[model samples]
Target: MTTAFDPVRIGALELANRIAMAPMTRSRAHGPGATATELMATYYEQRAGAGLIITEGAQPSVVGQGYPDTPGLHTAEQVEAWRATTDRVHAAGGAIFAQLLHTGRIGDAALLPGELIPVAPSAIPAAGQVYTHEGPKPYPTPRALTEAEIAETVDDFARAARNAVEAGFDGVELHGANGYLIQQFLSSNANRRTDGWGGTVEGRIRFAAEVTAAVAGAVGGDKVGLRISPGNTLHDIAEDDVEQTYKALVADIAGLDLAYLHIMESAGMRDLTASLRARFTGPLILNPNTLPEPTGPDALSLIEDGTADLVSYGALFLANPDLPARLAAGGPFNAPDRGTMFGGDQHGYTDYPTLT
Candidate 1:
């Protein structure tokens, strides 16, 4: 019987176990705008027990950032900042990848400083508020990206991918989930363009696929991966037909020959893997939200039965640095302090106790 501790090879990276540390944004970067801090590096080095560590969603450009202190990868200074962290993780004998994300319409006017109007697939403003430095700001009406601008954004993602490799990351994961730029393009409610990017599902997914191919070309196909959420609407995204839209999109992504496919597993009400598996023949990384119970044996069993190639844990790994060992020994895991989940000092970030 294969246990969670079993070593697994995912893409260009290999691990001692199938357990993975999901990319989680702590919003702890001191100087914002894509700059990584020493605290951030220390934070990652402490949690290297997992088979793999996918760093938090890093904004590809200035406008791609959403939160107050989230890191970016569009600058030389930012790249140098991240190199420090990656060097530490490598020295610890751990491998980590950067997850590239574009917040799209999730941006607040105040958060982005000069760029008040965020660019999205369409002009529709999501029905929600955004967390900003001062407070929550109502979702702003985003500008519809011009055909030229959309292509440039895709290039921004490609450039960010190239920067990640230069910064010493093992690979880059394209974030096509959480109602961001890619998801905004994927959502019919958000995308109303008649141009090459909007009408048909293929047209909408073209941005994501093209960006993936470009990044793969820049960083090698073996060093690229993508994460997707077919039915997620975290930022007021609306998908009319989840089945058809996702199936069509995945069918295109499946042939890309990238590293792995990360699925932010939602509810059992929707059988996610059933259709997507047919499209993507690579390793499947699963991230099940613990809406009720936190991560437990049942989640691991999915990996055991080969339903997923890897299991990604978010809060669990945040609270327990030695998460793999804790699970193996049936540990009393540390409960992550919700108040400190996003910001503050290193107290909650790296001070979480491992199993004694």
Candidate 2:
């Protein structure tokens, strides 16, 4: 019987196992010019037991950044800095993919260069606060991107994808999930534009599909993946009629034949996953967002049952460096310290001891 420990092929890259390390922001990019530091390399290399390591969200442009200490890929310096981390992961026999993220309206001007206000699909303020260098502040109403700016944003994603390849990453994953820029366009409450970019399901999905196509064109189609969280209301996004919107989205991008579609499991979305699995004709990575319960046997069962080709773990992979071996043994898992999950030194980042 096929198991999560079995090998799987994601696009042109061959994964040693079916377990993927989901991207989690560590806010430890303490290098000059928002570059990835050697500490980040050591951190990823320690967790290289994952079949595929999806690095933390990387801002594609200066204004796209949402948080402090997060890395970027727009400049030559950023790309060069990421190379060492990718090289370390590869040396450890792991395939790494840089997750290109554009935070959109989920940002604060205080966190951006020159205090640049965030741009979103619409000029509405999210119903929550965003963290900045000063502290947490209420989300400011973002400026809507003009048609020309939207085009430039698409080009930004494509350029970031190319930069990931130049940084020695095996591939790139577009961060279309959460309530970020892509999801900002997908949500009805967030995207109220009247142009071709909004007002309908087809229009709303246009930005995501166009971004995917452009990235795939810049890199290889098989070297690109997308992550989506339908019905996710994070960052104050209101995704009314999630079923209709996501079905249209999946249908629109199915023809792209990209590497994989990563779907985060949400409450009341099981049937939607089933429908999406049938609709998308490529590999699927399921992120079972069930916390407290360890993603050990249950996640493998998803792969065994054909609901997902692979499974991704976030906190488990963060605390357990040799997660594959630990899962195989099914004993003695380390608990992650919530305090150090975000910004921190090597204490919780690279000091996790592997089974000896």
Candidate 3:
């Protein structure tokens, strides 16, 4: 029987354990040009015990940034800064992947540079507020992408994947979930275009497929992964045909021979999860059941039962630096500080005590 403690293979890389640290936004990328700081390296180094660590969402381009202080993977300085963190993690015997995210309609212009507004498949505004340096503000109506610009956006993801490799990351994961740019195109309500980028199921899934193929072309397919959420309503997204949308999306990309497919599961979507699990022939990483609590020790059984190839933890891994050791011991884990979870100093960032 497989346990979370067992080793798993993702592409050419061999993970030490099946327990993975999910990508989370800590809002602590406080460097110039959104470059990673040495302090950030310390934070990841502390958690190097995990089999794999997926870093926070990094904007692939300047306009892709949706929040203040998030990191990027588009420039030489940014790549050079990230190389420090990746070098440290590799030295500590850990594998890391940079998640390339483009927040289309979920951002405010104040968060971006040079007065550039958010871009989406359509001009609709998400019905919520995004946090900025000033505080929380309403989401601005995004400019719709032109047909030429859509091709350019795909190129941006490919370029970022190349940049990620240059920074010494083991791989790159496309942020297709969580109401970001990729999901915006997948959303029925958010994406109201009639072009090849949106409209029917095939058109809606086109952008995602193109980006995946482009990234795979840039970085080998074995070094690429894609994350998705079927029925997630975050950022005021609504999917009338959630099942059809994701099944088609999975089928379209399954032949890419990618590294993994990560699903951020929502409430009562286990059947859909099972279907996707069956359709996708690669390694499947599941952050299961978004309801009563964060993914807990109980989810370890998902691996034993073959429901997931690897299990990802967000808050649990954030608070417990040596989470795998704690789990192996049936742990008395430390609780995460909510207030300091976002943008703060070392109090909640790297100050979490590990069970020694």
Candidate 4:
């Protein structure tokens, strides 16, 4: 029988344990596209003991960037930068994946190079101003993407997946949540298009399905994963029929042979773990998430009950570099300072010490 802590195969990859390093944004990219610095590389290398590590959301293209200092896989230099990090993790006997993200309406074109109009499925602007290098600025109304343009965006993800593999990553995860482009298409409020890309359930899901197919084809379905939140209302998203919307997505993507379906049980929504599992035939990684800082409330029990194949943790990994050791030993954790959570010195980034 398979246990949560026991090694299990997800698609073509086999993991030593079931604990995963949840994808968290650190915004430490050394300016330009996705140029990860030595410090960023070391930060992930230190936590290689986990069963899996999912890096912060990486924009597939320049216009996809949400934060000022977030990383990207759109350039040759950026791929080289990530190669060092993935090499380090592989040397440490770890498996890692890059989360490909496109901010879409969640960003401001003014903050991006050439003021790229921040395209989305519709022209609706995200509710709030995005924090940029200069400061927070009101989000500009995104120009709706033409049908041909939507296809181009899907191709961008395929190209990024190839870039991720070239950068030495084991696999790639499609960031389908938190108000990014993928989620925008799934959302009724954000995506009001009447064409092939939006309106009805299947229409709204067309873009995501195409992107998933594209990435899977580029990087092999066995090596690709997707992260989603059913009732996630972030970034001005509003999904009317949460159950129906996600059911279709889970069913449609399962045929692609994805590694695992990562569902984030975010705030305000009824627990979706059971409902989501019904549609997915692959391994399931559950994020029984809490506030900014996570307290799992017997997170292991979910695995014990067979509700999830693995548990991906976020803030806990932020404060404890050796998160597996701390969980195994039951040691007091170091709290991450809010000041350094975004972008700054290594104070809150790599300075946290492992329990000795």
Candidate 5:
């Protein structure tokens, strides 16, 4: 039986182990232009022991931003800023993938330039609050994106993927999960359009398929990946037909021959994941733990049972830098500070002590 510490091949990239650092939103990009800073590079460099590192969600465009202080890939300066971070990860013998996120309707105008209203698949307002410089505010009803604008959004993702490659990243992962722009289109409640982009399952999955194909076309298919949550209700997203919807989605993108399909598992969604695994023919990275539960022996079991090719850990990897060695030795592991999990200085970001 293969262990999680063993080497695994994901598309054209060869990973040293089966462990992956899942992307978590750390609002520490306080650079001049919302670009990645030296501190961010240090944070990632410290945690470069993982087989793969999926950086925090980066907005493909200015309006794609949903949170405060998150990074973007829409500008040349941003790409230049990210290059240093990627170089550090590469020097440390780690492969990194940039995650492209468009927050869609799950945003506030206060976070946008000139108080620009956020855009989504439809004019629906997610029933929650979004973080802003002032504080948390109720999510506003986002403007419906026109068909032309939707096409432009697809191009934005493609351009961002190319920019990631230019920034020295190994690949790009499209954030199609967590009620963001792509998931908003996947959810019938959020996307009520009657045009070619909505109504049927094929229509709803069109955006994600197009975005994946565009990114694969921009970069190589082996350098592009996608993440999805089948029954996730985060950020007020409701998928009435989770089974059929995600099945259609997996089938639609199965032929892309992309790098991997990352699935953030919801509670009691193992059968759905298995079904998706059958539909997809590439590498599968499974994030089994949601909140509160720490990833440990259970994640390894997913790999041992062949349910996942790679297992992703978020909070555990955030807290422990040398997670692969710690797990192999079965010894001490550092606890992550909840308060410093978001915006903070080097204290919780890069100050985690490694096993000496």
Candidate 6:
């Protein structure tokens, strides 16, 4: 039986272990052009013990950014800035993937530059507030993307994937989970369109499929990965037919021969998880739904049972830089500092002690 510490092959790369450090938003991209900072490089280097390190979501386009201080890959300077982080991780014998995310309608206008507003499949406004640099503000009604803009957005993802490779990342993961742009299009409530992009299940999954294909084409299918949440309702997203929608979407892209399919499981979706896992023949990385409590070391057994090829940990890896080492020993893990989890200094970001 394989364990979390076992080696696994993901696409053209071979990871040293099945322990992956999940992408997390630390909101500390304090570089020019929303680029990554040297501190961010240090943070990633500290956690290089993991088999893979998926960086925080970086917007593919300028308008794709929904939060302050989040990094982006839309500019040359941004591409150059990320090199430091990727180089540090590689030098430490770790593989890294840049997660490209676009917040369709979950952002506040205050976070955007100039008079630009958010864009989604439709002009509908999601219920809830988004945290801005100024304060928490209500989500604004996003402008519906014209068919031409939709095509352009797809191109943007492809371009970003190329940029990620140029920046020295092992691969790129499209953020189709956590109520982002891709999930916005997949949501019945969020995406109420009547064009080729929405309405029918086929239409709704079109944008996601196109984006994936484009990115895969830009940076070989073997260098691409996608993250999705089948039944997640975060940011007021409602999916009446969760299983049917995701099943179709996975089937649509399964032929791409992607590097992996990452599922951020929601509550009571174990059956859906198994179904999707069986549908996609590629490696599967699971961030299981152990809500009310962050994913713990116990999830490693999922690998031994063949439930997932690799298990991802968020909060656990955040607090413990050498999380795999601690898990191997089976004790003495550091608790994540809730208050300092986001938008802070080295105290909570890279100051976590390792069992040296």
TM-scores for all predictions: 0.96, 0.98, 0.98, 0.96, 0.98, 0.98
Separate clash counts for every candidate: 2, 0, 0, 0, 0, 0
Q: What digit string (tens of lDDT, one per residue) describes model 6 on residues 91-127?
A: 9999999999999898877767898999999999989
**Candidate 5 or 1, higher TM-score:** 5
User: Model 6's lDDT to the true fold?
Assistant: 0.92
**Where is model 6 more than 4 Å wrong at Cα?**
291-294
Clashes of 6: 0
Candidate 3, 1-356: lDDT as tens digits = 99898999999999999988999999999999899999899999998888899999999999999988899999999999998899999999999999999999988798776868999999999998998878889999999999999999999999999999999999999999989999999999999999888889988989999999999999999999999988999999888689999999999988889999999999899999999999998999998856444445678888999989998989988899999998888888898888888887788999899887
Error of 6 at 36 (Å): 0.5
Q: Say which prediction, candidate 1 or candidate 6, comes out ahead on lDDT.
A: 6
> Compared with the true structure, what per-residue lDDT tens digits does model 2 show for residues 1-356?
78999999988988999999999999999998899999999999988889899999999999999888999999999999999999999999999999999999998787776758999999999998987668789999999999999999999999999999999999999998899999999999999999999998899999999999999999988989999998888998888778998888889888878889999888878899989989998899999885345878888888888889999999989999899999989957899888888786898999988899
Q: Which regions of candidate 2 deviate over 4 angstroms?
A: none
The TM-score between candidate 4 and the true structure equals 0.96
Per-residue lDDT of candidate 4, residues 127-202 (tens digit):
8778776888988899898988888889899999999999999899999988889999999999998887788899
Off by over 4 Å in 4: 1-3, 267-271, 291-297
Model 6 RMSD vs true structure: 1.0
Worst 10 residues of 2 by lDDT: 290-299
State the TM-score for model 3.
Answer: 0.98
Which structure is stronger by TM-score: 4 or 5? 5
Model 3 clash number: 0
Model 1, 1-356: lDDT tens per residue?
77678877777677888888998889887864558999899999987777889999999988888887899999999999999889999998888999999999888766666645688988899998987767788889998888898878888998999999999999999999989999999888899988889888777787877888888878887788899887787889887777777787777766667888888866762366756865787888888774444576767887888778888898888989988888887777788888888878888898987766
**Candidate topping lDDT:** 6
Cand. 2 Cα-lDDT: 0.91
Lowest lDDT sum, 10 consecutive residues, model 4, at 290-299
